[model samples]
Target: MHIAAQAYGRTSKTGLPTRELEATLLSQSAARLAAARDRRADDFALVVEALEENRKLWSLLVRASSAPESELPDALKQNVAKLGAFIFQKTIDLIENAEPEGFTALAEINRNIAAGLRGIPADA
Candidate 1:
């Protein structure tokens, strides 16, 4: 998928308070993945399936968060937060399991993701 190309345009069309929050989380995840790519773009490209799964999760978060009004709420916001955290943690676990020696990539990705998430506007 055109994940790298598409992620840069991420934003919320839905006025739902959680939409921007979701976009923020997804953008941060994408940035983390990008950091991994920077460290070993060729290596990650070899694990296309893992990368594809990451893209799928990101896409799901975007769509779910951006859904129209009347279908959104604070509970969904909490779920979004939970989901983002879960994804990041799971990614780290995967890295640890599959390439323990490559922990730097995992650590860097998590750090970048956290930083990006922190940058999101709270007024959403």
Candidate 2:
């Protein structure tokens, strides 16, 4: 079976579907933010790192969603763009202030998006 699977060009064991990868990445990012918030007084640098990573991911998402060939609906693209903008602004604010409170909004955004990608039903 393993040989047949390999011959059939099965994806590498470490490879994940696009949606799963996004959700996993988002989860990891949220966890980083939580950790940063928890350790702000002892090691604030971790907060900066977490925020920076989140910023990069959101930037990529914005660009991908904005692509002309993207299959996402216009409404979804608009929403993603708006969220990306907010993420950008919030990240900047966090960088300047380095407050643990700022992580809440960012983490929530990531968590919700990840849940959506995972096909988890949203709250009514």
The model with the greatest lDDT is 2
Query: Each model's C-alpha lDDT?
Result: 0.51, 0.80
Q: Which consecutive 10 residues in model 2 have the weakest lDDT in total? A: 1-10
**Deviation (Å) of 87 in candidate 2:** 0.7
Q: Write the per-residue lDDT of candidate 2 for residues 1-124, one digit (tens) a residue.
A: 2222232233356566766766777787888888887887788689888888888878777887899999999999999999999999999898788776788878988999999999986572
Tell me the TM-score of each prediction against the true structure.
0.34, 0.83
* 13-104 per-residue lDDT for model 1 (tens digits): 44434444544545554555555555553576434444445646555654555566535587866666575566656565655554433334
> Judged by lDDT against the true structure, how good is candidate 2?
0.80
Q: What is the lDDT, from 0 to 100, of the residue 51 in candidate 2?
A: 86
* Model 2 segments more than 4 A misplaced: 1-15
Clashing pairs in 2: none
